[model samples]
Target: MKRIPRETMVFLLCSTFYRLASGALLVSLTWNILNQESISYFPLALAILCSFIPAFVTPTLIRRLTRKFNGRQMSARFLLGLAILTLVAGACRYDTSALLVTNLFVWLLFLLLEASLDMWFTQVQRGLAPAQVQRLSGATTASSQAALMIGPLLAAGLTPLLGNLGFSMMLTAIFLVVAAICHSAGQPPITSNDTGSDTKAQELPLALFIPMLLVWPTLGAFNFMLPVNVMVQGWSLLELGILDASFGLGMALIGVLVIAGVSGSRLLAFLSGLLTLSAAAASAWLLLPQDLLFRCACLGLLGMAFGGARIQIRAAIAQRLDEAAVGRSVSRANALGTPVLLVVLLIQLGAIATAWALPFLMVMLSIALLMRLALQRSQPHSAAPDATPYS
Candidate 1:
């Protein structure tokens, strides 16, 4: 197997740290908002809605930016801008109106950071062989998951000591600065011929789209509801952090295993869907009960499902699309599903009955299962003989 280049590794590391800071900010901001005496669900929902805007807009913006600046430069500028925004958000933390405005800008910056990193990785992928792309993609995801594991703990510890507003923002800004510096280190340009137009293009399998669309919103809804669940259960920040960490750990472990060929993607997706479905059922039937252990267990299951499903979806895309198209394909996939996710968030914010949440989750699970079965039935026998079960 070809070794991943040193520069590529550095870029991945920077991306991981950026992700860590982003995740930490998200948890802290959401916690702070929800903890408010007034309980600002509309602002929280609006913030989430704001986050998705860059997903639609950034692709075109990135294309233009890359014309003037290299990927590394673009990423650094975005990170620095994000750091500044974090400080501003911290300064404005006391006023609800200011906080909401700052939070919206902060999410926009965060999304830009993600978009820049995605563009950087897509370039890196263009330079590697298919096998290398698969390997590095898995490694990159696993590292991000590891960051997720650490981020919450860092946030929980810092929030109490730093007072959840200006101080936490300052600390997060420092992390972003570090990420900026690391990302600014130049990487060798990918010059691989594999990304050329002559390479045969395969239509993305319909089955892959199932996980692609559902996994993100499913996870989003879960995360969106989590703080409320934790509060209702009377759990402390530390416990909530632990639950968040468990989910990340599950994702990291499962991602590494799937990348190593321990299991097939479809099978993992099926199992994950079932696990998520079961967890949702338990949560609903039990009426969002207060047991910490049970909550942790459910979170862990959700994390594992998210991790596995993400890997499966990405891997399937990698298998089908050339490097040039992978990034755009992913962006399109996410864009297509944004409306669905928005509706889920809207429902949550509208003070819709909690009873409806479980049913919505079940519907998603059922669709995933049916899609998997349909994919299997659609595959011809000859293709089956050559296909890796996991692929």
Candidate 2:
């Protein structure tokens, strides 16, 4: 067995923190605040609205900072900044009148943390051999999901003792302190070891970045519609939550298998197309009347599809770009895509729309894109060793 690099370890740690925040308490924390009438759901809504803020800026920040500072140095600065910010926001979590204000500040801290992770992830992209990305990303994701499972339980157990505000504050403190420590343990950035080739990386043009940005949001739009569709079909929250957990389980299981097999580029791309098709088929199934069992199956299938696609795309991206560029590229993709998702979700929320059908459409379209890429990879004219970021 190969030893994991230090960067991968840091990625896993950040994943743990992120999952604890986003996956664990993300919705439930909002639910708690809304139920208590301490803060209107509007703030939560706004935070979601602004969720992609860091995605748009992070890439640019990396581009600028990496020229001067090594990856580890930049990551350390980012973590330290996030720690201070989260601590300050945690201190203010108890002010009800300031709930929205405090929440927004906390959100800003989160965005910054995300940016920091992206910076460190840049190191992972540059340092690891191409074959290692799948396991590394999978490990990062696994730690995150594991944290997700733990975070909710932690939040629940602690809420009883600490109150809602106190629990959030405690989490805030833990994340900041832990983040700072993790950064200190990381290795210096790739700039420290020059390959001695004076070749500067070709910057990804906006044209390329724009398409990548649009793609994920289109996929995300379908995800945002799932709960709405389920509710419209009159499924209870218990049913929906159960279905979601099942979906997550499917993804987790597949991801674990892929890591174990050390899945390769060809298999990754093939699965990308295959999974997109399955997701499309599952979404299309929603057009029919909802059968609880059938819907559960479809959700699980979609989860597997998502897991496959995620690993494939991540590998593809890592193959072509530096760590800083990859994060920025992904952030670009996410930032643009999230707004589209938001709009589509709003449309789904409105009357007189076939919003339920959108996920199927989006998935099918993504499948079409994947199919094209797969075909391109097969063509004799395709360069055997092109190094374009998109390749």
Candidate 3:
């Protein structure tokens, strides 16, 4: 393995810590909301929809923000703000309206921080060779997945001692503070060339966006269903956390082994679609009669599939677009897919088990098949002899 750069190492460390905290908070928040007597699926779904509002505009927002503030400064500020918001949310956890409002802001801050980190990653990739970019991207993704795997375990251990709100507040503050320190200490100088030249922008292939459109909703629906399943099954919060951790482990393993090794666009897309379909199937199975071990297996499979698909889709997009266009292309994909998520959330809110699960599974499978066809059709036209490898 090549020696990782100091800046990259710092960035990855901070990102990993942030991801851990975010993952824990996600589980804790869902558990808390579901456990509440007054809370119902509608409000929770609405909150989720509101949370994704930032993703719809992330590309435009990041573009303008990066012009005024460098990635490090922006990320640091967002982290600090997020820390403050998290504390406030924890303090007001008993108030449903307050929690909902606070969580929305939390997601907004989180997305902004994500945008800054992604922008920095893109800029950093611009300074590396293609092979290095692939290795670094895989390593960074794997590290984040590792954090995600650990996060739920931490949440499970801490929730008993500190309570859900207290755990969330403490974890967010600690991790965000460390992340802020890392960002402040290792702030990279942004050169004028960090943004791409003003040459005519290349058209991003439609096939590149297909996976994002299909996979995100599948993942989102799985997340929505998991907490509900836990609630219906009368499982403990710790079990929920563990299940989430299992999913994270699956993602981490795939990131390290599969996505890191694969390179061809068609192959990546095919794998991404296949994994997504598998995740959806697993999610549907989770709603069926099964032993504890079987359920756990399904959760693990879901995680692995979701993780593998996510990395491949990202790799596919990166392989096709210039570094500068990556942000916009991804943001546009998210924007287009946002409504799909809203619909999925609404379906979940209805709490119709078979209706939602069956349709979701069918749709996921259909999309996966379509994406495979799309990739196959586009490969002949798009693949270049000297094209960058996606591995």
Candidate 4:
């Protein structure tokens, strides 16, 4: 067996920790606070919005930091910030007055930190061979999703014994600290090995912008559509949860295959995911839209496609950009995509009576395909022999 790289291993661990704190732990904390009537859902909604306020500064901050810190150093800085914020948030566990403020800062730091980790991972992946990059990124994505699943179960088992506030905060802080430590350890000297500062990598690709603008809302359609489907059909929340889990299952299944050294074209990966999603949505709407079992299958296929698209998109970016440029490009893509995603979601939400999943999927798929084709024609980059995926 080939030895896994130190940087990749650390990245997987950090990814795990990030998902736990961001997804499970925060949800747990919010649920507890809501149970106590210490805070309302509206403020929590606002907290989420405010979190992305820092996105405006990310491109500039990352560019300046990339001049000095290696990938690990950049990740460690943000992780350490997240650790501290997690500690501070413990005080808001039951306090009505502090809950809003704590949530605001904690979520803000969490997002910024996540973006930094994306930068780190992108930098690391570009250094390895294409096959190795596939395995490692797949492993990391799987580990992250696993953590989200495992964390809530762990919280359920532990909350009874140790209580919520102290246990959650302490464990989250410690977990983040460990992630930072691991990411910082086994570091290779930059002068000798790292190429994150390559001159060609400094410029963000022009092709990425329009395509990215289309990508997010299309991918995010799954999230908005599924919930509405459940509401309209009067399906059980348990079934909804299962459907969600099925999506993750699809992603993990694909990741497992990639980790086993399966390879394929980047362009195919991206397109197949969108097409699978479109086909599944079309099938579900036409045939078994209300059948829980069939719906689960469709969601699973959609997830697999999404998983493939995610891997290829990041790899494509890393193929062209250095650490800072990758950070700038991704962060910008996310920021721009977020608003369009929100708009699409809100339009759907406002017309819940008419927001069928099939139409949404078809429209987004069309836009995504057109933008994807336009970008491909302009760049001519995905044809790199190594960028080719499964034969």
TM-score: which is higher, 3 or 4? 3
Residue pairs in clash, model 4: 263-389, 263-390, 264-389, 264-390, 265-389
Better of 2 and 3 by lDDT: 3
With a 3 Å backbone cut-off (N, CA, C), the pairs that clash in candidate 2 are 122-323, 213-333, 217-337
Which lDDT value does model 1 have at 370? 39
Candidate 4 wrong stretches, greater than 4 Å: 29-47, 88-90, 94-100, 155-162, 189-207, 210-245, 261-270, 281-299, 353-391
Model 3 is weakest, by summed lDDT over 10 consecutive residues, at 192-201
RMSD per candidate (Å) reads 4.6, 5.0, 3.9, 5.3
lDDT tens readout by residue for model 4, 72-100: 67667666666776666665677755666
Predicted structure with the largest TM-score when compared to the true one:
3
Residue 168, candidate 3: C-alpha displacement in angstroms: 3.5
Model 3, span 174-235: residue lDDT tens: 76776567556655565433345532344444444566665546656766777666766677
Which stretches of candidate 3 lie above 4 Å from their native place? 127-131, 185-188, 191-200, 213-216, 259-288, 319-324, 355-391
Task: Write model 2 residue lDDT over 1-391, tens digit each, in one string.
Answer: 8776655666677667755654434434333333334323333334444545555665566556656665455545654554454444445454444545544444544554554565566566665665576666566555554565455456545666876556656666665666575656747535422232522453443433443554545544543454445545665435545555555555566577667754555653655645564765555465645677766667556655655555555556666665555555665566566667677656655531466466555544554554455555557476234323232
Best by lDDT: 3
Off by over 4 Å in 2: 32-47, 53-56, 67-115, 125-128, 149-162, 190-244, 272-277, 280-297, 351-364, 380-391
lDDT of candidate model 2 versus the reference = 0.54
lDDT value, candidate 3, whole model = 0.64
Q: Which model, 1 or 2, shows the larger TM-score?
A: 1
